[model samples]
Target: MKPEVSIVIPSYKNSPLDLENLHKNIANLDYPQVKVKVVNIKVSEGKKRIGYAEAANKGILRNKSDLILLINADTKLDKDLLKILVGYTRKNPEVGIVGPKVYSMSDPLEVSPVDLPVLSFNKFFGKMKKVDPLWLENKRKPFSVAWISGSCMLFRRRVWKKLSGFEKNYFMYWEDADFCMRTRNLGYKVFLVPNAKIWHRSGASIGKDNPERIYYVKRNSLYFLEKYTLPPGVILNGIKTTFLIFVKTLRYFLGEKEVSKAYIRAVFDYLRRKKG
Candidate 1:
């Protein structure tokens, strides 16, 4: 028998029409024939809203499937996407986590397999390139990566039991990479299945380059770096990464004053958090 699959989508809504397109895509997935369960996780409590990490944690704890596919509401849920991902995981028990080669909806060729968040200028600022010409030959092969975007990821239920899901405190950024690192630490590899493609409306759920995104990303980058950097490397890593932080601030300051302010505040907040 095929392992049971459950899809958990964490959405923050302004109105019911918020997930209208995403719902339509799911409705188009031939639900009558497909056997997967879909759980729509609303990240709201009363009038206020919660973070993606908290919402996903709740969804995972509530579901009881053999496999879990967590995706954002802004992604195009292709007809064959779930089947392909499930088949790959069923075949490779060694893979604790798997994600697809997601392309930007604005441009299909541009794909990014998330890299490990190491303390380096290149690691944080470098952009992902388009798929290889060989990919055009339709050789949708699987490859290992340090991490992949949280936008669309698949993992076994057992992995969730072990890792306890995303760190709820992270709220949004860096938690995906943090989870991947912890998963690998348990002797399981994280693989990217390129053929299992989908389109993510990049920055649709949250505006691109907005203050919230900028602040969370910068704040969480520091948290992630501090967590991963060992004792002996802490001082050196802090000095080098601090320089990159100012460099990032300068780049944003040249473009938008508000964004620069958010960057500065992120550092201050993270520092204050450290002092506490």
Candidate 2:
């Protein structure tokens, strides 16, 4: 039996090229009973009140299906991706959330450019890329991961209901990781289906180099680190990140043309905000 699938896509003021890429990707998808819900988010209007987490939550709330997919506006799903994920979730009762191996749209078989920052979480979870000649020859099975990128992920609706969905406290960064950890604490596994694939337009939701993006990444990450992990670790990492921000600010003050003063403001936001 084919399960119902709901795809929740969050879009900002995406470039024409990015939207075109996304539309092209979904144009030929083969899923039979699928519903797509799009939530358009503009940062200027969102204003820390509703960031990615809230936008994504809005999309999720608008959906009604047994399976939920959180997708970015810049992704294209493979024809069989939903079938594989939904099947896995059904066969593996212990699995709650499932994600595909996302590749770069520019380089379909390669990792996306934004894959770096979350490498720490991947390593911590023992999901280092599989590299073996024989293993490469065989079809891979769904395997557990610490967390999956929010760009393209699928979850059981029941699992999401049980976990109470993404934390509204988080504005942007690390919400996926925090949610994954919450799922884990509830004793459900997060799976990465290597065979199920999608092409991701890197950093389409957040302008990769935008000073505002830098700010939210810093501020929301601090919130994540403080909430579930040790404070000392949070403080230590915060100090290092804060120093980097100061150095960038100093460069801007010295009349560096490209380094933005907005970057410094982000650091202040990170340091001073009350916990949400």
Candidate 3:
């Protein structure tokens, strides 16, 4: 018998169209023992907006399957995506989480794998890059990665229980990295399944470069740094990342003043939260 899999999609009212497409994609999957559940924040709580972590946790708590797959409403999966992900976990008990080789909806041929966290210029950032076609053709094996994008992730139900679901404090960003880091610390490996393909409408729910997105991303980066890094490293990285945010503010000052203000407010917000 196949292991049961539960797919949790956290979405809002504005994402209904995209959610419809995602539903169709999942409905056509070749896998038989799969359940798809959508937790609509707007409809469930009578609120227009809710944190991604909270919405995802809602769906997770309702499901009692052997494996759980968390995917974005704007993502469309290939027919075998679930099958491949489930296969990986069944084959390797040590593998805690598995994510697919994602492709941008605009460019289907391009391989957009989630970047591993990198420390550059004395600051940390997710380093995403399109996979070279030649390199992809040469290397077909699934490889271990530091972290995978939250757009689409699969993990054993036991692991989810162990971590107690995503940290509710993280409203939107850095939550995946936090979960992956905790999984690694607990001795479980994260892997990327090259054959399981997913097409993502990047930033579909939240417009690209929107000020609200800027605020949450900047605020959460600092929060993640504080939680994961040592005292001196956290302080140093905070300083370096703040400098980068300053550069961003300067660049957006003229055309997008709100974005600049959001960046500044993010720092203040994080600082205030730290103090209290």
lDDT per residue (tens digit) for residues 1-276 in model 1: 566677888886524564777767766763344466666777777876677888888887777887898988878867777778888888889999898777777766665333211222123323223334335235466877777778889998888889887887788877888888789889998888877777787677668788978888888877776776565455665676688778877877688678878877888888888311
lDDT (Cα, 0-100) at 253 in candidate 2: 72
> Which sections of candidate 2 miss by over 4 Å?
15-24, 33-49, 116-139, 256-260, 274-276
lDDT of 3 by residue, 120-140 (tens): 212233322434444754456
**Ranked candidates, highest TM-score first:** 3, 1, 2
Stretches off by above 4 angstroms in model 1 are: 13-18, 30-34, 47-49, 112-139, 231-233, 244-255, 274-276
TM-score of 2: 0.81
Model 3 lDDT-worst window of ten: 114-123
Model 1 clashing residue pairs (backbone): none
Better of 1 and 3 by TM-score: 3
Estimate the overall C-alpha local distance difference test score of candidate 1. Answer: 0.73
lDDT of 2: 0.69
Greater lDDT among 2 and 3 belongs to: 3
Candidate 2 clash pair list: none
Residue 239 miss distance in model 3 (angstroms): 2.4
lDDT of 2 by residue, 110-215 (tens): 6554642132343222223433323422437766766778888888888788877888666666788788878888999887887888878777666677766766
Shift of residue 263 alpha carbon in model 3, Å: 0.7
